[model samples]
Target: MTAELLEFLEELSRALIASGNSVTDTERILWSVAESQGVEVEVSVLPTMIIIKAEGEVSRMGLAAQSPGMMPLHQVTEIYRLTDDVTSRRMEVGEALGELRGI
Candidate 1:
């Protein structure tokens, strides 16, 4: 898997966590999002963590704390924009990572 794709997944997982979704739900949503972006991946989500397996070789996992709170619409919109930009090659992974961190 490409580094850019990996970075995208990581940021997306973070976004979902920030949105107050359970890790399992985040995994499901992220799988759909990736597919919508024309990327295929295998994901396994536990209550406290998410595991993504890509191209049968690369795997990435993220551990999330349990912080349940509503995410503002504007923040979610920004995340969607970031996903679009990176997936469409309009932005670099590093740049997107920086933006996501700020969010």
Candidate 2:
């Protein structure tokens, strides 16, 4: 299921590029689709990048195993939000450092 989802995002990315759509416009379209599909995405914009995450209230979202009785952290990074569009992408210097350290 995840592989299929990744493939779908890749194709969607390609189509967005082919259509000459800007990232901002793409995000708007993406939000519209997500709303209809019952997925919630929160966009955090940096100077030249955007981070997408699933929406949760002030409570009820986290990392960890997510088993019925598992406890998760309150930290944001550990939580993951699925991305439906891959056309919008960026990497961070801190993440690069973590990769360098084999984290």
Candidate 3:
């Protein structure tokens, strides 16, 4: 589950950044989503990469390559929707990953 959570977080951060969200906004969203799952995460979002450190019984760090870019308004909206679903627990990690990838 932790591994899945890390993968989901990385994907979510990348999507947010590519949608033109600022680092602060991305961090807040990640924190919210992690909190919903009762996980503590330290996330760093940059134009070139996203780094996430999850603290728990077994702590781990994951990185996802990111490139600075902007998406269409509709695509950005879809990404936000998926993020809301994850933060609200309306979607599971696997489901959210699929949805994010689809967007």
Pick by TM-score: which candidate is best?
3
Model 2 scores a TM of 0.35
Model 3: lowest-lDDT 10 consecutive positions: 56-65
User: Would you list the clashing residue pairs of candidate 1?
Assistant: none
lDDT of 3 by residue, 14-95 (tens): 7887777888898899889988998888877776577788885344444545554557899899998888888888889899
The lDDT-based order of candidates, best leading, equals: 3, 1, 2
Local distance difference test scores for all models: 0.72, 0.35, 0.81
* Residues 1-103, model 1: lDDT tens digits: 2556666687678677777667677777667656655678887776567777766657888875545677889988888788778667687667877888888
* TM per candidate: 0.67, 0.35, 0.85
Off by over 4 Å in 3: 56-69
Give candidate 2 regions above 4 Å deviation.
1-10, 44-51, 56-103
Compare candidates 2 and 3 on lDDT and give the better one. Answer: 3
| Candidate that would win on lDDT | 3
